[model samples]
Target: RRLKKKHFVIECDPLVHEGFESTARHVEIPYLPMLVPPTKWKGYDKGGHLFLPSYVMRTHGVKDQKEAIKSVPRKQLRKVFEALDILGGTKWRVNRRVHDVVETIWSRGGGIAGLVDKGNIPLPEQPETEDPDEIQKWKWSVKKTKKANRELHAERCDTELKLSVARKMREEDGFYYPHNLDFRGRAYPMHPHLSHLGSDLCRGVLEYAEGRPLGKSGLRWLKIHLANKYGGGIEKLSHESKLTFVEDHLPDIFDSAANPVDGNCWWINAEDPFQCLAACMDLSNALESSSPHGAVSHLPIHQDGSCNGLQHYAALGRDYMGAAAVNLVPGEKPADIYSEIAARVLDVVREDSMKDPATDPSVPLAKVLVDEVSLLPAPLCLNQEIFFFMYLFFNKTVEDLDIGSLQVDRKLVKQTVMTSVYGVTFIGARQQIMKRLQEKGHITDDKLLYDVSCYATRVTLDALGQMFQSARAIMAWLGDCAKMIASKNQPVRWTSPVGLPVVQPYKKYKNYMIRTSLQCLALRREGDAIATQRQKAAFPPNFVHSLDSSHMMMTAITCKEAGLHFAGVHDSFWVHACDVDKMNQILREQFVELYSMPILENLLEEFQTLFPTVEFPPCPAQGNFDVREVLTSTYFFN
Candidate 1:
C-alpha cells in the first residue's frame, strides 16, 4: 500500500517525475526512492555515532561503510580528503540560549531585520493618476518593492529552515556536518541548513562539543576574538589593544549576555550581532567562574585574511606596497584596505571637482557666446541661458557638490573593491554601489542615487587600479592567456598548487524543449562550441580561486597533522582559542610554501603542452619582495 501511494505521488507530480528522469539519465540503473515508515524517533546509535545513509556513502558502485570516503582524486588530493575528513568529524552542538533567541526572531520573520531595519517590507506609495508617465513610474516602483519583498521572504524561509534543524539537533550529544569540495576544490559543508558555514545567527547557535580549558593565553585570545566581532576600528587594533577594548566593554558585554533582549541590547549594534552575543556569553561565563583561566570554552576563534584575493595577487607579484597594504608584512596593527581604498577614491573625487573649467579640455563649455552690449534687461538671451546651464555643469561648488553627502566610506566601496579582482565590469560596479546606497537609505531620488553610484564606481575602480598596479597587470596577463586559449574553441585548464585538476567548464549550451505531462520544460545541454568571452572573463578569478583553495587545503592538512581542529570559510580560518597561534603559524607557512613554487611559469608550460601550436605570452614579471616575509607577518591572516 505504501509502495502504491509512493508511485501514485511520483506519477501525479510533474516536478518529481522530471527530477527522477534527470537522475535516471546520470545513472546506469535507476532505483526507486527509499521509503522510511513513520515510527518513534531514534536520533543516533547508542555510542553517539551518526552514520551517513548507504546511498549518501556510495559512488561508482562502491559503498564506503567505515569512513565514507569517496573516490580520491590523487595523492595530493588524499591529504585534502584527509583534511576534509578531520573537519567533518569535528563535533558541534547548539548553544540553547542563543538558539532560543534565534528561534524567536525566526518566528517573527525578523531574522533579516537585525541586519537591515524594515528591509523586508518595502511599500512604495501608489500614484492615483491616469497619466501614462506617472503610471509607468508607479509600475517601476511596484516592481522594485516586489523584488525587495521577495528577497526578504526568501531570507525568512532560510532562517525558518535553519532554526528548525537546530531545534531538532539540539537534544543530541553532538552532531557533525559532512564536507565536500566544489569543482574549484573549495571545501564546504554538505549539510545545507546548519553548519559553521552559516550566517552570524547560525554560527552563534553552534559551539564545539569538545571543550578545551581556556588557559591564560586562551583567555586573552578569546577577548581578542570578542573585539574582532565588534568590528570597526576594534578589529584593526593590535592583540593587546583588542584585549584592552574587550576589557573596556566588559560592562556592556556582560549586560548583553545577561539580558540580551531586554537590557541595553549592546550586542545588536555589533558587526555580527548574534555571534557577538555568543562571544559575550562566553566571556561572561569565563569571568564569573571561580577560576577564570581554567574555564572550559568551545567557541571557535577566527583569524581572517585581509582582502585575501588581493593578498594572493600581491604575494604572487611580490608587490611590497600592495603586500603591506593588505597586512602581508609585519605590522603593529592590521591594515585597513577598505579605508585606504575609500580615501583614495575621495582624493580622486576632490581632484576631479577642483579641475579648472577654463583650462581643462575635458570640461564642458557653453556653445553660445554673447557680447556685453547685447545684454537684455527684460529677459535673458539664448547665450545667457546656455551659459547659466553650463555654469552648473562645469562649476559645481564644494557646497553644491556635497561630496560628504555621498558618505564615501569603506562600506560603500568594499564590495566593488573586493570584486574588482574578479573582473567586475563598470555596470556591475555601479549596480553593487547602487545596492549599497539603497541599503543606506540616504539618497531617496532613484535618478540621483544611480548617478552617485555611477560616480562612486568609477572612482573606486580608478583607486584600485592605482593602488594595485601589479595585480592589474597580472589580471590582464591572465585574461590575455585565457583569450588566446579560448579563441581556439578550447576551455582553459590549469592545476592548482595542491595538484587539484581544474578545468574551466564554460561552454555554449543548446536549449531544447522537453514536453512533460503538465508542462514543456526548456532544458539546456552542453554544446561543442566553447563560450570564448565567458572563458576569458572567468579564467583569472577562477584561477585565483583555485590557488586560494589550494592554500586553504594546505593549511587544513597541516592543522590536522599538528593535532588542531580546523574550520575554514574560504579566506577566514577558525580554530580553538588555545590552538589559534599554532593554526596561524601553519597557515602562514603553507601560504609561503604554496607561493614559493614557480606557479605562473608552470601554468605557462602546461598551456604550451596542452596546446602545442598556440603560443602563450611570457609570465608576468615578479617584484623584488621576498615571499618568506609572510612568515614574520603577524597580521598576514588576522
Candidate 2:
C-alpha cells in the first residue's frame, strides 16, 4: 500500500465544492472527482473533471461545462465596498508587521546567513586526495647544530671591541654609532677587528649594499639585522618589522609638516639612535675632547632618558615634556629640559632643510620628510574633504582656481563636508597629492575640479597605452613640462654622460623670456625713431600688484584682545615669531572675543549673502572705545 500524501485546500466559499462527491464515493473512492482530468470527465457524473460548477450555469440552466465556464470572467473584479474594506482594515496592518520585523533585523545588521541553512547554501566540498606513494618517497634528514655559549671573558671582550669600534668610527668618520653590540639571530657579536666604524655607520653601509634609500632603509636594515643573523629582504620582512622600521626612521623621515611622511605623528621613546648620535657629537664638541672615543668615554651617564629617533625630527621639547612627566622625582620641579631639546632639534632640522641634497639641484623645502612614505601609518582613515582638497592641490594649478573667493551656499554641507577642521579629510592620499602640487606652486581649494582634471589625465593616458609603458612615463612628461614652464627664462637640455646634448622640441618654449625679450629689444633698436620711442613708452611696468587683496595688504592682524574689554592703549597686533607664548595667547583671546558687537556686526555684514538675519550691536564711540561691550552683546544675542 502507498503512503498517503497530506493536502488541504482552503475554499473561497464554503458551498462552492460542498457535496460535489456522493456519500458512498466520499467514504471510499478510487480518486476524487474534483481533481480528475478532462479525459476522465465522463466518469464524473456530477462534478465535472478539470472544471467546477458555475453559479451562472445553475441560474441560466446552461448545460455545457465549456460554455458555462466561458460565461464567468477569468479575473474576478471585486466590488468597490469590499476593496475599500480590505484597504481600511487588517490586510495592510498584517503586511506592515512583516515589514517592521524585516526592518528591525536589517537595522540590526542582518545578513544573508540568517535566511540560509548550511546544507541549502550550495557549498561544494572538495574530494580528499591522498598520495601514499609521494609520502612513502619523502625522506627525512638530520642537520648538525652547535650550541656554544660564550664564556664571560669572551663576552667582555666582544663588548669592549664593539664599544671601541663605535668610538673609532665616531672619531674618524662623521657617522653615528649604535648603543649596543647584540645581533638578532647570531650568538656571536660582530667582531671589532672586522669593523672599526660604529654600528650605525656599518648598518648604513649594509643598507646601501642592499639597494635601499639612506633614510629609513638603514634603520629598517638595522632592526632586521638585529632580529636575524641573515637579515630578511624588504619584501620578506614582516608587517610588525616594517612598522618598527617606520618608528625608527620617523624623526629623520618626517621632520616637519612640509616634509610630512609616514609615521609623522607617532610618539616614541626619547633616546633614539639619531638623537644619541647627535648628542654624542654635541657632548664631544662641548667637552673639548680630543678624540671622539675620548669624548664618548668621558661623557656622563644620561640622567634623563635618551632621545628617541622619532624625537629627532619633531619638537624634542614635546618628547622632553613627556619624559619629564615620567622621569619626575618626588617634589622635584619640572626640569626645563623640554626647552633645551626643542631648541636643539629645531636647530638641527632647520639647518638640515637648508642643506642641498647630493641627489638633485632642487632646494630642500625648509623641511625634511621624516619617513619615506608620508601616509604609511594607516592613511585611509583621513577626512574626505581634506583628501579632496589635497587631491586638487596636488594635480592642478592654483592659477586656474579662485576657490578662496568662491562660497558654499548650504550651511549643512559647508560645515560637515566642505569646511576645514571638522570636514572629512583623507590625510595620506591628500597629502601625497598636495605635496606634489605644492612643489609645482599650485595650492588651491577647488578639489573636485582638480579631481576631474586628474580623471581626464588618467583616461587620456589609458588611451595612450600603446605609446607609453606606464602612467609614470606620463607623469615624468608632465614634470618636464612643469620644469619648462618654471624655467622659461633659462634653456636646459638633457645631456648624455659621454654624448653631445640633445635638443628636445617639446622643451623649445623654455627660452620663452629670452626669445621674447631679445625680439622686443631688436624691434626697439631697428624700428624708426618715432616708433622706437612709442614702443619704449608702451612697455608695461616691471611689477604689478597681485589681484587678491589678502596678499597685497602687506600686513595682517596677528593678535587681538577678548571679552568686551574697552580698548585702552593696545590694539590688536600681528607679529611673525617662532615663539609659542604670544601666538597661544592671541589665539585664546580671539577665541573668547569673536562675538563682540562691532566684530559681530562686521561678520554679519561680511557674511550677509550667506547668513542673513544675523545682527550686531553697536560699540560705544565714547572713552576707551568699548569694543568689548559690542563684542559681548553680539555674542549673547547670537
Candidate 1 Cα outliers beyond 4 Å, as residue runs: 1-73, 108-136, 357-406, 514-521
- The digit string of per-residue lDDT tens for model 2 on 1-638 reads 99996655654442332222112122322221111112211111221222433121121221222232333333321121121111111100011211233233333433221211111122233334466654333311111111111132233333333333333333231221111101010011112231212232222111100111112222322222222211112112242443454344434333311121122311112112222232222222323434422221111111111121111101111222232322211111222222223223333334444676775322242232211223312123122223224433463221122121111111102121111111123442244333444443333455543552243223222322322122222223323432432243322122111111112112111122234522422221211112222212111100000001111011112322221101000111111111112333433333223312232133224333333343323221222222222112211110
Q: Which digits, one per residue and each the tens of the lDDT, describe model 1 over residues 237-314?
A: 577767766776799999988988768888887778888888999989999999998999999999899889999899
lDDT of model 2, residue 336: 23
What are the RMSD figures for all models against the true structure?
12.1, 42.1
lDDT of each: 0.71, 0.23
What TM-score does candidate 2 reach?
0.15
Per lDDT, the best of the predicted structures is: 1
Query: What is the Cα-based lDDT of residue 185 in candidate 1?
Result: 65
Q: How many residue pairs of model 2 clash at the backbone?
A: 39
C-alpha-based local distance difference test score of model 1: 0.71
